[model samples]
Target: MGNIQKITPNFWFDNQAEEAAQFYTSIFDDSEIVKVSRYLNEGQEIHGQSEGAVMTVDFKLNGQKFVALNGGPQFKFNEAISFIVHCATQEEVDYYWDKLSEGGDESAQQCGWLKDKFGVSWQIIPDILPELLSSSDRDKSEKVMKEMLQMKKIDINLLKEVDQA
Candidate 1:
């Protein structure tokens, strides 16, 4: 037939695929759970998940397709990969940062990055972040980068203010 219709990012969880997908779809707009499939005896020999247990959850977050797999805990989520929540305003950034950081590792928060309770890293960033950090004026961009390094959630106003300084 045709080429691959979509590229779905798969998330591996330790029996928390359903929970993580629900939480993610709830946070983002225009998102929803498409379907869920439970484990069967087909390949339980390796997975070890009991029958009827969650196997996969297909979902959409902010209109992006994703799949959550209830894989065992042989692997862990680390900072190597992170989802970026781009916002147009400070309020949007704050809202996402608050929700994503809830029940998360507070110590892991830095430079607009935080790990959610499920250990998934997220970057709550302003839409103009790139422009601010790549401004024609080196001083402005450098200062913005420096200021950003000291904060947990991104501070759009602070970045703008520092840009002028």
Candidate 2:
């Protein structure tokens, strides 16, 4: 495959590269697995993976490119890095939140941020959030900010009502 994207995010997994790629592809529209590569005996001493085992998976989600690597447990994903999903409507927000957060870390959920079962952090935000939070009217912005801080998943209707109030 050609390097169409200048930069691509690579996810390092202990051994779930293919699984995670499949899960992510299933959650988004216009997504699919592009290619998969297996470990070769030449790197057995360094990678410590069995021959022919999954080593990397190339995939696309809604046109965004990503790579998943079976890099072992030397490192792990954290909240410091997260993928943001911007939703145009409440239904869109709800759909992504419910699907991505399944079997995920519930305690990490706050202000529309969640950690999936694979420990990858994600922020599910409304498209109007920036406008609401950055409005010139401090009163409206403050109300939205306060309400947002108290939410695990953003309630667009409540935010809108609070903004109007």
Candidate 3:
């Protein structure tokens, strides 16, 4: 058998499991759609999905496994849960922020957080963000925090400037 992940995040979509999976795979490297399962006649009454409709999509994004389910509109994504994308450089943060925020809700963006078209929340942050925000120097940390709060996309250079100021 292939390797199995102990825990996997399942994304609920309103009939867009396949589409969401494809979109995510396209944005990240080393990503691919692993399997697609179709709804069957047996569960048609409860699921309300056509027998041939895509029911679930198993995919991997940069080696992390995930499941996208066409589970209808009973639930929606919120900021309470978010995927954090740690980046080593501003270029990486910019790349991920732009790609993930395309077609997403602009009003939902703040402090490096964005909601994708699928309503999934993502945080595109620099690897040094945690360090800067939790520094021993209260003034430097507070300055960095203020700058970060003002940004929709994280600016590594601006955060670093807090140290010199």
TM-score of 3: 0.97
| Model 2 pairs whose backbones collide | none
Screening candidate 3 with a backbone cut-off below 3 angstroms (N, C-alpha, C), the clashing residue pairs are none
Candidate 3 stretches with Cα past 4 Å from truth are none
Query: Weakest 10 consecutive residues, lDDT, candidate 2?
Result: 1-10
Candidate 2 wrong stretches, greater than 4 Å: 1-3
- Could you give candidate 1's per-residue lDDT for residues 1-165 as a string of tens digits? 845536779999999999999899889999999999999988888889999999999998887889999999988999999998889999999899998899999999999999999999999989999999999999889999999999988898999999999
**Predicted candidate 2 versus true structure: per-residue lDDT over 43-83, tens digit per residue:** 79999999999999999999999999999999999999999
lDDT of each: 0.92, 0.97, 0.94
Question: What residue runs in model 1 are displaced by over 4 Å at the alpha carbon?
Answer: 1-5
- Residue 30, model 2: Cα distance from true site in angstroms: 1.0
Flag the better candidate by lDDT, 2 or 3: 2
Per-prediction TM-score, please? Answer: 0.94, 0.98, 0.97
Best candidate, lDDT: 2
Instruction: Provide the RMSD of all predictions against the true structure, rounded to 1 decimal.
Output: 1.6, 1.0, 0.8
* Per-residue accuracy of model 3 over 4-39 as CA lDDT, tens digit each: 799999999999999999999999999999999999
Candidate 3 local distance difference test against the native: 0.94
